[model samples]
Target: MSSFQNDTAHFAGLTEKQTATARLLAEGFTAKEIAARLTISESAATKRIEALRQKFGGITKNELARLAREEFSGSPSSHTVKVFEKNRDFSRAPDGEKLTWKNFDLPNTDGFRNSMPRNRPETELNFSDGFTLDATPPWRARREERLVPEVLDGEHAAPARWAYVVGAAIGMAILLLVLLAVADALGNLA
Candidate 1:
């Protein structure tokens, strides 16, 4: 037996990231593929593997992989392929048949689309320009309402106007301060 066969002490010092890298390596993944799976750069993945190598008594990567496989050999790996029956098509539903429009006996309303009523006869408000402003499905109309800004035209308008003016003044002041700071930095650099 190899010295690593009975050794679980080597895994005790590993960080969670290193453990995950080791698990992937054990499942026959290349460092590049491990990087993609871990959402890290290839160099980062290689560094992690190298770190693992150092921790495992300066062993080669292949030996590290073998150790990893043994370490995780008892647990189920997702990459392990299960045997399927030779007569079965696993991708397709066993009882399902191919469906087309003819299966439902649907009418072929090809070019007669314009002849169909755009809005239901019972609908209270339907704009000719294709806006359904009524409340059957309230969310759609509410979405359209949110897209348009309200025009202020009453006692509240003066306060709103003043608020806009104040906001503009503050924005311009901030912009002027930034430009002055940049100019000062540029002058100092020269």
Candidate 2:
């Protein structure tokens, strides 16, 4: 058999579609390319790749491809190849033998009919415990609670205050120099 067919022979447990997906993946096809080539949706192709990952003991795509090539190339002592061969015999149990919820009681349909109040009279509205019917707005009620007030007031203000001080000092220095120059000119005029 050709190498591709021989490589795929190790994945006998997979469905035909899954087998095709594994082959395409081993051939270095992207999920989008696999989808287009197999006439399946991209999501379906992605799911097939994910299933292949799981079936091969959660190895990556590159590792899976390498394992496939090694197996096909007749490397008989590969542990991963043995795992693939062992997974083939794991047939699912019959439906009747499987655990299901058939014996559980069906839920009561009428139990939720009046669970919530519907159109109660406004006069009958009383606040429950831990609840308030008061008309006070949230912002007014919690006006004392400031978010990050320390960071806003202390940390941010320090740099701004230093900048203002430096700017004021520079302004004063420039004003003093201008005054000195004007006094020197007035003395020269005299």
Candidate 3:
């Protein structure tokens, strides 16, 4: 028997639909193509693929395919896949009327008292006294004074400063030499 057939034999409990989906996926068919072939929605095909991934304890489609192939081919895999029960109660919302910020007591920071949205109570949105909305750009404000390190602001910086000066002087000299060479070549041509 082919490896794929052998692998499928090991997973005999798979539903007919799951088996068909897996076969198509193993054959490199995209979810859209599989959906069309199976007469199902693309989202349904994607969900099937995700379900297969979860069943095989695979984080990726490729891993899921490998797991399927290994299981079908009678190869023993080290990882054990766990099945989880779906929780219906987790999807339920709390049983109560919707509560807005107006229902709670909050302090207003800004002097403007009427900034709350229409129909909402004044206590809905409150800013603390420490909060200040400055219209000016943050960068334009006076910055805290910082002390400069001696290496950067004192005689310790002389060596680096001199190095920059010497480097600039050398670059200028090279530029002048190149210009002079060009001028000499033009003069020779004339």
lDDT (CA) per prediction: 0.69, 0.65, 0.63
RMSD of 1: 24.2
lDDT tens per residue, model 1, 1-190:
1233333667666889999999999888999999999999999999999999877666667657766776677544323322223243334633222111122456778766868677677667656755666456744444344432343455587787778789999999999999999999999998
Task: State the lDDT of candidate 3 residue by residue for 84-135, as single tens digits.
Answer: 2232232342332111112244677564565755566667767578768757
Q: Would you list the clashing residue pairs of candidate 1?
A: none
- Number of clashing pairs, model 2? 0
- Number of colliding residue pairs in model 3: 4
lDDT of 3 at 132: 80
Of candidates 3 and 1, the better by TM-score:
1
Candidate 2: 10-residue stretch with minimal lDDT: 81-90
By TM-score, rank the candidates, best first. Answer: 1, 2, 3
Q: Rank by lDDT, descending?
A: 1, 2, 3
Among all candidates shown, the one with the greatest lDDT: 1
- Clashes per candidate, residues 3 or more apart or on different chains: 0, 0, 4
> Which whole-number lDDT from 0 to 100 does residue 127 have in model 1?
60
TM-scores for the candidates: 0.37, 0.34, 0.32
TM-score of 1: 0.37
Q: Once superposed on the true structure, which residue ranges of model 3 sit more than 4 Å away at CA?
A: 1-10, 70-190
Candidate 3 at 166: error in angstroms? Answer: 81
User: Which pairs clash in the backbone of model 2?
Assistant: none
